[model samples]
Target: MHLIIPNWAGVPANIGALATLRSGGVSQGPYDDGNGGGGLNIGAHVEDAPQAVVLNRALLGVLLPASPLWLTQVHGHHVVDAGEVDNVPGAVEADAAIATRPGVVCAIQTADCLPVLFADVNGRVVGAAHAGWRGLQGGVLQNTVARMRASGAGPIVAWLGAAIGPGKFEVGADVLQAFTDTAQAPEAAVGASAEMTPAARMAQTQACFTPIAQRPSKYLADIYQLARIALGQAGVTQIYGGGLCTVTDINCYSYRRDRVTGRMASLIWLK
Candidate 1:
């Protein structure tokens, strides 16, 4: 299947990373191009044909050192060690995966939700996170970093994969408050205000959530920016790969655009 190589630089040669596109596989109907063509549909839980999912994974396997640790994501903040799940395939229930052992690929499936890949400067460890709004607000990114650090990873570099862009990801007031209520005001802002109130802290968190014109209580949230904010909070400064939008780009799958669309995968592993 066609894979998009990550555009990150300075990462060690041992680290191999790429995100899959919705092309080059054997599937049909909603799982394929709907006209009997090669469509790489890898999500087994999305009601795709079991044999098709297996064949898609087999196609993906031909390019990797070993099988990837596929996660059954529930939009929750659960990060699992990839080394511990070498034989389980897609049986693990987690939103993120981290790997230090060689050839243990950490993989995350996404249609519109942001798939974030992480690697240390020295290539000692790598991780993949599924950052939907709920998981992002609940600290999935933070938890991934924490797991990597606890396993001896150094300063982390992150690569954001294709996701629904801010213009297409509309949300209600509750989604906005979910981020603002938990977000703390920047130290500089707090100092400037002398005593920042809850309202002020909430305001400071508005940079990533923009209100749509004439749409009251509705907002367009920038998941990419929110991911950067979360990664920065975990001391990860080197972040890349966030311009691609799944919703607008036909090359990638987007659940928002088509509810029956296939899922793409973002993966990272050390050689």
Candidate 2:
């Protein structure tokens, strides 16, 4: 199956990370690759054929050390320990997962939503978070970094995976207000503005949302910039991989582009 090995520098040799593309599997119909071939749809809860998902996951399993710990993402800020839910029978409800031990893969499935992979400089711990707009606004990345630090990680770095690009991600006034309100909140300025004044930080956050002239209260929201602001708030500055756009990149799946579609997975683990 096609995969994207993160090009992050200073990543320890023992940390394994990859983002899957939508190709090289047995799924058909809407789940098939955009080129009319089989797709590597890894999400089992997207109404894809059960047997097809099984076959596709098996195809992906050949490249990994063990089965991935999948979560029932709710676009919330809950973070879970991968080792605790790796082999569990039922679905674990969380937006992010962290793994401290080797062979326990932390995975996040996404279509148009952003998938972020995390690793410390020393590879002591790794994490994966599914950050849609809701999750981003809810502080998922900050929570993930916090949990990683608590689990003995140091100086974390993050890599953004495929998602809808800012040019194509249209949003309403509520979306703009949500971020603005958060940026102006007293607690939000504490760590995020440590390097700058609260006014400057607010400007940085507001700059991510550009007004759409044709649409009265709509704006083009840059998910990547929003994520950077969130990470900055958590004291993580070394970040990478934010240019890929699932909506326009045929190699990846986009739920917004196609209402009914499969999902791609971003995974990270210690070797």
Residue lDDT tens for model 2, 1-271: 7889998988899999999999999999799988889989988888999999989888888889999887889999999999976465237899999999999999899999999999999889999999999999999999999999999998888999999999999999999889888887777865657767667867888899999997799999999999989998988889999989999998989988998899998999999
TM-score of 2: 0.97
What is the lDDT of every predicted structure here? 0.85, 0.90
Span of ten consecutive residues with least summed lDDT in model 1: 185-194
TM-score of each: 0.92, 0.97
Screening candidate 1 with a backbone cut-off below 3 angstroms (N, C-alpha, C), the clashing residue pairs are: none
What's the distance in Å from true for residue 212, model 1?
Answer: 1.5
**Model 1 ranges with Cα > 4 A deviation:** 33-36, 185-201
